[model samples]
Target chain A: MKVTILGCYSATPRTFTNPTSQVLEVRNHLFLIDCGEGTQVQLRKYKIKFSRIKHIFISHLHGDHFFGLPGLISTFRLLGRESELHIYGPKGIKEAVTLFLKLGDSWTNYPLIFHELESKDTELLFEDDSVSVSTIPLDHRVYTNGFLFKEKPAPRKLDVKATTKHNIDRSQFNNIKNGANGKTANGVEVANQKLTLDPPNPKSYAFCSDTAYNETILPLIENVDVLYHESTFLESESRLCQKTKHATAKQAAQIAHKAQVGNLILGHYSTRYKSIDLFKEEALEVFPRVALADDGKSFDI
Target chain B: MKVTILGCYSATPRTFTNPTSQVLEVRNHLFLIDCGEGTQVQLRKYKIKFSRIKHIFISHLHGDHFFGLPGLISTFRLLGRESELHIYGPKGIKEAVTLFLKLGDSWTNYPLIFHELESKDTELLFEDDSVSVSTIPLDHRVYTNGFLFKEKPAPRKLDVKATTKHNIDRSQFNNIKNGANGKTANGVEVANQKLTLDPPNPKSYAFCSDTAYNETILPLIENVDVLYHESTFLESESRLCQKTKHATAKQAAQIAHKAQVGNLILGHYSTRYKSIDLFKEEALEVFPRVALADDGKSFDI
Candidate 1:
C-alpha cells in the first residue's frame, strides 16, 4: 500500500499551504480521501491519473474536506469519462451535490453513486476479495468517520522445486497453494506444508482527521501498519484543542503509541504556525516512529 | 478604475491555467467578478486584500464561473470577517450556495446578502454615489448576464490659479466645485466655467463572458472605456462556437468594432489552443485597440 499527501493544512488554503486531502493507492485501486478545494490542480501537479480514481471517501462535510468534489465530478464529465464513480460521505452530501448539479444543469453522463453514511459506530463500509474497508467513528464538531483500509491475505505460495521433487502433477499445484494435501503422480500423499510456503503478511492503513483526542477509535485502528492522524496544534495549544474539537501533536502521538501502530504520520497543521517541525518534535516524545505529512509527499507501507 | 485578472481561461481548472474569475476596483470599492475554483489561492498569490472585497458578481450558474464562492465565503468566516458580503447572480445561485452551507453546518457569522436575478433584459443591479452597475443580457446555454460598471461623474476640479484670479474665496470654492456659480467678494458674478475645469472623463468597464456573439449587448455596453468579451475560439472554430454558444476572437472584435469602445480585452480562450497569441492576432484584425487577458495581469481603464 502507498499513500500520497495532496494537502495537509487546517482551515483555509494559503499560497504555500493547502487544506486536508490525500490519495491512497492499495490493492490495484486508487482511492481519494477528503478532497479539499484545489485538489484537481494538485492531482494534475502530482501527475496522478484522474480517471483512475473510482472511489472517494469523505470524512466530514466541512468545506476543507469536500469542497472540491463537485468540480471534480464535473471535470470527469467534461473529460468524457464513462465509468461509474462512487462517493462515500456524510448524510447531507447527496443533497448538497445534487443541488449544485441541478442548478448548473450539468447532470453527468456517467453514473454517480453516493453512499451516505450516518452510523456513529464502527462498521464495515466496503469489502472485496483483495481489500476491505471499515469505518472508525470519531469525535468531532460534526458527524465524522475515519476509514481503515486492509489488504486481505493472499493465497499460499507453491514451492515449484518441492512439488517437482514429489512428482506432483501441475494441476495439483493449485490445490497445494489452497492449503490442500497434494498427491504425487505415483499416488503418494505429500504434506501441504512441504509443498507450499507461507505468504507475506497483509498490510493495513488508517486515516483520521478533523477530530479530537478520543480513545474509542484506538481499538479499530490498533496494530495497523500505518496510521495518519490530524495534529492541528502543538502541546502549547492544548486548550485551543478543547475549544475547537481538534487534537494536538502530543495527543496524536499518544494515540499512536497506545495503538501500537508501526508508523504514525501527523498532518493538518494549523496555518498560524510557521514551522511544522515542532509537531514532529512533540510527536517523537511519545511515539518513536513518526513522520510529518507534507503536500506532494508520498509514503510506501 | 483598475481591473485585475485572477483567472481567465474557460472550462476546468488546470495546473497551469485557471478558470474564469477576476477582481475589479472602481470608485474606491473592490468588486470580485466570477470566482472559479482555486480563486482564493489566486487572490493570495496576487496579494489582493480579501477583506476589501464587498461585493461579488457571478456571471452565471456555470461551475467555472462560481464554484469558488462557497469556499471563499467559508474562508471569510474562518478568518473572522465581520463585514457583510453581497453576492449577485442568477436565480438558482441562492439555492445552490445555501444548500452547500447547510450541509457543512457553517452558517456565516457575518451578514450574507444574495441578489438573485431572473431578467432577460438589461437592468440596473447595483448603485452607489460614485458607481453604478447594470446587467447586459447575453446568449448562452444557461441563464447568463454580463456586467457593466460605470463610474459616476466626479465633482468638477477647481483650477487653483483660475479660482484665485477670479477672486473666489476659499469658503466658496467648495460650492463652485459642486457645480455652483460662485459670487466674488466684491459681489460680482464669477462664471463657474471660468473658475472650474471639467474632471477627467468618468471611465466605464464592461465584462461579457461565456456568451455567444449577440448584437443586442452592443447598445448596452456602447462606447465603454474597456470591454472584456469572451473569445472562446478562433475564426477556424467558428462552427464549434455556434454549436457551443460561444464567440470566436473575430466575433468578439466585431462586437468591439460595432460598440466603438476605447479598448477591447479578449479572454476565455479554449484550452485546445497551444498559443494564446493567436487570439490577439485574430482579434487585432478587426479591432486595433485589443488586449489579451492573462492570469495575474492588471489593466488601468
Candidate 2:
C-alpha cells in the first residue's frame, strides 16, 4: 500500500501551502480523502491519474475539506469519464453536491453515487474480499468521522519444498493451498499442515482529521499500521485547539501513542508558522515513530 | 480603470492554465468576476489582496465560471473579515452558496448579501456615482448574462485657467463641475462650459464570456472603451463553437468591430490550442485593434 499527500495546510489555501487532501493506493484501488479547494490542480501537478479515483471519503462538510469535490466531478464529466464514482461523507453532502449540479444544469455522464454518513457509531461503509472500511465517530463542532481501511489476510501459501518432500500429489495442489487435506487414489491421508504455511498478516491505515483529542476512537484505530492525524496547531496555540475543536501536534501524538499505532503522520499545519519543525519536535516527545506530512510526500506501508 | 486577468482559459482548469476569472479595478473597488476553480490560488500567485475585493460577479452557474465562489467566501470568513460582501449572480446561486455554508455549519461574521439576477432585459445590477454595471443578455447553454461596467463621466474638469480668466468665484466650482450655470450676486449668469471643460470621457469596460457568436449584445456594449469577449475556439473549430454554444475568435472580433469598441480583448482560449497568439491573429483578421488576454496581464482603460 502507498499513500500520497497532495495538501496539508489548515484553514485555507496559500501560496506555499494547501488545504487537506490525500490519495491512498491499496489493493489496486485509489481512494481520495477530503478533496480541498485546488485539489484538481494539485492532482495535475502530481501527475496522479484522474480516472483512477473511484472512491472518495470526506471527513466533514468544511470547505477546506470538500470544496473541490464539485469541480473534480465536473472535470470528470468534461473529460468523458464513464466510470462510477462513490462518495461517502456526512449527511447533507448529497444535497449540497446535487444543488451545484442542478444549478449548473450539467449532469455527469457517469454514474455518481453518494453515501451519506449520519450514524454516530462505528459502521462498515465499504467491503470487498481484499479490504474493508469503517467509520470512527469523532468529536468535532460538526458531524465528522475518521475512516479505517483494513486489508484482509492473504490466502495460505503452499510450501513447495515441504509438499514435494511429503509426496503431495499434483491433483491435491489446490486443496493444499487452501489448507485442506486431500485423499489420493491409494486412500492415504495427506496432512494440510505439512504442505501449507500460514498467510502473512494484513496491514491497516487510519485517517483522522479536523477533530479534537478523543480517546473513543482508540479501539477503531488501535495498532493500525499507519495513522494520519491532523495537527492544526503547535503547542503555543494549544488553548485555541480546544476552542476550535482541532487537534494540536502534541495531542495527535498522544492519541497515536495510546492507540499503539505503528507509525504516526502529522499534517494540516496552520499557515501562521513558517517552519513545521516545531510540530515534529513536539509530536516526537510522545511518539518516537512520528513523521511530519508534507505536500507531495509519499509513504509505503 | 485597470483590468487584470486571473484566468481566461475555457472549460477546465489545467496544470499550468486556469478557467474563467478576472479582477477589474475601477475607482477604488477590486471587482472579482467569474470565479472558476483554483481562483483563490491564482489570486495568491498574482499577489492580489483578497480583502480588497468587496464585490464578486458570477456570470453563470457553470462549474468553470463560478465553482470557486464558495471557497473564496469561506476563506474570507476564516480570515476574520468583518466588512460586508456583495455577490451578484444568476438565480439559484444564493441557495447553492447558502447550502454549502449550512452543511459545513460555518457562518460568516461579515454580512454576505446575494443579489440574484432574474431579469432578461438590461438592468442595473450594481452602481454608484463613479461606476455603473448593467447586464447584457447572451445566448448560452444556460441562463446567462454578461456585464458592462461603465465608468460614469468623471466630474467635469474645472479649467482653472479658464475659470480665472472668466473671473468665476472659487465657491462656484461645484456648480461649474455639475454643468450648472453659475448665478452671481448681481443677477449675472456664467455658462458652465465657459468655466469648466469635460473630464477625459470616463472610460468604460464590458465583459462577455461563455456565450455564442451573437450580435444582440452589440448595442449594450457599443462604443465601450474596452471590451473583454470570450473566444473559446479558432475559426477552424467554429463548428464546435456553435455546437457547444461558445464563440470563436473571429466571431468575438466581429462583434467588437460592429460595436465600435475602442479596444478588443480576446480570451477564453480552448485547451486544445498550444499558444494564445493564434487567438490574437484570428481576431486581428476581423478587428485590427485586438489583443489576447493573458493571466495576470493588466490593461489600463
Best by lDDT: 1
Model 1 lDDT tens row, B170-274? 998788888889788889998899988888899999999989999999889899999999999999999988778899999999999999999999999999999
lDDT of 1: 0.92
Which parts of model 1 are misplaced by more than 4 Å? none
Q: Highest TM-score, which number?
A: 1
Error of 2 at B86 (Å): 0.8
Question: Once model 2 is optimally superposed onto the true structure by TM-score, how far is the C-alpha of residue A86 displaced, in angstroms?
Answer: 0.6
Candidate 2 residue-wise lDDT, B1-301, digit = tens: 9999989998888877889999999988899999998899889999899899999999999999999999999989988999999999999999999999998889888999999998889899888989888899888899888999988878777888976666677788887787887755565787877777767788889999989998999889999989999999999988897678999999999999999999999998888988889999989989989988988889999
What's the C-alpha lDDT at position B213 in model 2? 91
lDDT of 1 by residue, A218-296 (tens): 8998999999999999989899988889999999999999999999999999988879999999999999999999999
Can you list the residue pairs that collide in candidate 2?
none
